[model samples]
Target: MPEFAEEAEVTADAKRAVRVAVLARRRASTADQRATAAARVQAELVALVRRLRPRLVAAYVPVGTEPGGPDLPGVLAGALPAGARLLLPVLRDDLDLDWGAWTGPENLVAAGRGMREPAGPRLGMTAVAGAELVVVPAVAVDRRGLRLGRGGGSYDRALVRVPADTLTVVPLHDGELVDRLPAAPHDRAVRAVVTPTDGLRTLNGKPGVVPHTSAGRTGGQ
Candidate 1:
């Protein structure tokens, strides 16, 4: 039992180190670079929406220096087919995520944790299960689709509500996609990643198919 606890601690430390490094890199990015990455990421996501034609999409508004840029919600709204709805995450007190509808930029209000969330009525966590496509945020993702988040576990909890077959993706800056990342038992792995330079790359051979198995060493390996 002690050995298992120590192993978990080591994994947490590794993830923290990676998070610090990645956030530093993001902080150093100039406005122009962020703009360019934003454009590219938006383009890729737009393309994905077009291809999937999802009647409902679950996504979030990116905060400062986060990938997908501040304009992402608007960009996605423009790309989605008419009458289709966009759901943005609302952070709950327990750090779990509740969903809300993205009506427009004006409807988005400043939220806790440096986030911008929809001001509309709250949708239960299970709303994500109804989305045909889910776009999440990641500090980084490995080729195996193991995601490194900000350690809040908000998205991790929300992701479990997503159907295994629903298309889940993350948008990243050019080099944020790496060979591997540390994972814990509750961590969720995504099916694909979208980067400024690479556009979209599916980790699973088949696109949009997320393996229900956890990505930690004891599980995925």
Candidate 2:
């Protein structure tokens, strides 16, 4: 698919912003600063989880170069309901990912490209098609719901099979939410945004509006 020129510009700017933020985060002189940011981000993630309750959640385990810190594991550990089945992505040789269940932190093992993946049985791409919510990691997101992902385009391919109404979301630090993003035809638009301090914001319309419908389950085109 041809890339969207406007989307590309939005993505480039978003990447620049996130790269700067990551650098600043890495340069914090004191342990306290790093700890504080982690705690704040965790709190925001917990709030987002609460607001998205009862939905089958598909979230990622952070990798070395990913923007979100180690907070994701801890947030998933504490926030997910007992009855809720947590799903994680498993990258294949082709750079596409398949879904699997995460029993707990121990269920994750080191995978190719230095990523941590669930040890659970492969649940196939169709599993993603069934999810009610999918929390994706992005380099940046614009007001129109365009998300700039890491260059691999793995999520874009994986998401093509997901139900259209699924409450797809991308979580970033506060400033990662921007006015616009670079979009491509293959790039998917998420329904919401979750930030370290903002909880969850519906992005299909107003910035702060919370979406009321249960995440939709229509498979990707």
Q: Each candidate's TM vs. the true structure? A: 0.92, 0.75
Tens-digit lDDT string for candidate 2 (1-221): 35566666776686667656654654543555545545655565565566667447788886543445654765765677778877889988998998888777877888876778888799987688877778788767787887777667788888888887777877665567788655656777887776645555677575443434222211111
Note each model's CA RMSD in angstroms: 5.9, 6.2
Clashing pairs in 2: 7-182, 7-183, 8-182, 10-181, 10-182, 11-182, 163-218, 164-218, 165-216, 166-216
Give the residue spans of candidate 2 off by over 4 A: 1-34, 65-68, 206-221
Clashes of each: 0, 10
Global CA lDDT of candidate 1, please?
0.85
Identify the leading candidate in terms of lDDT: 1
Q: Candidate 2 has what TM-score?
A: 0.75
By summed lDDT, the worst window of 10 consecutive residues in model 1 runs over: 212-221
| Model 2 lDDT, residue 62, Cα | 63
Question: In TM-score terms, which candidate is top?
Answer: 1
